[model samples]
Target: MAHYRASESKREQFRRYLEKAGVMDGLTNVLVALYEATEKPNDALDFIKQHLGPGADSTDAEGSRVELSELQHKYDLLLEENKELKNRLLQYEPAADHRGVE
Candidate 1:
């Protein structure tokens, strides 16, 4: 009887912690979405792994290479965008300053 009460108290504390942390809602949503999408009973484990695993961060060389190449391409694209925005800002600054002087 004493052990049962202690276990119940621990369970209640865990439930309250999950509710306070907003984890219940997020976890419920993820599990529900996966359940709705699943066609077979075994798909739940696969879907969970696909959604929550390291994704592309595998230890294999090909996976590492692919991730590295993708990140490099994104970095290059952002750098070009930054350069274009700076050029446009320079073009606008002179006009704004000229108007302020008048």
Candidate 2:
């Protein structure tokens, strides 16, 4: 009984390690895909489809949803800043435009 328990514990540990490794591999693959997409999105999609199994599309979709949400938030902030800069530019334009007349 003691020997069997010891063997079983070792097996469980090995399985856990394997599972962790697999997750790590998946994450690495995802990062690589993102990098590839940055350069060539269609190629990246093809690579994901070839390498990431049938569920790859769903996984990529979820990842894209998250990225899009973040990008939208950033874009809103940038648009606000752009508006502020344009207002500032307009303020300067009136003074500069009047300088020659004065």
Candidate 3:
């Protein structure tokens, strides 16, 4: 129980420190936007740059990400189907008779 209270006290102190630094609100807003993103970014650094840098996209980023994912799924399905068809074709090739064809 003592350890738990100590942990909670430390958390409050850290929260107060963040609030005093004036960075808590900015961080919270940035994190909320990241949460609302359709395609979650893997790299936090790159994600921050895309939002705060001059090269940020004026177009819809989530829409583009969704379209790209759809295309990738289609590509994977087509590739698997192609592999199956190739295996089926190989099975249909007439086997050469060893009596004279050899």
Choose the strongest candidate by lDDT. Answer: 3
Q: Candidate 2 on 1-102: residue-level lDDT in tens? A: 999999999999987897777965875777686776656665665676666676667878899899999999999999999999999998768766466653
Which parts of model 3 have CA positions greater than 4 angstroms off? 1-55, 94-102
Pairs in steric clash, model 1: none
Worst 10 residues of 2 by lDDT: 93-102
Give the better candidate number (1 or 3) by lDDT. Answer: 3
Error of 3 at 57 (Å): 3.7
* Model 1 lDDT tens row, 1-102: 999999999999999999999878767776886768746456677766665455623556577788999999999999999999999999778765466643
RMSD of 1: 11.3
Q: Candidates 1 and 3: which is better by TM-score?
A: 1
Q: Which ten residues in a row have the lowest lDDT in candidate 3?
A: 93-102
TM-score of 1: 0.42
lDDT of each: 0.78, 0.79, 0.82
Model 1 shows how many backbone clashes? 0
What is the total number of backbone clashes in candidate 2?
0
Query: Candidate 2: lDDT of 78?
Result: 100
lDDT of 3 at 78: 100
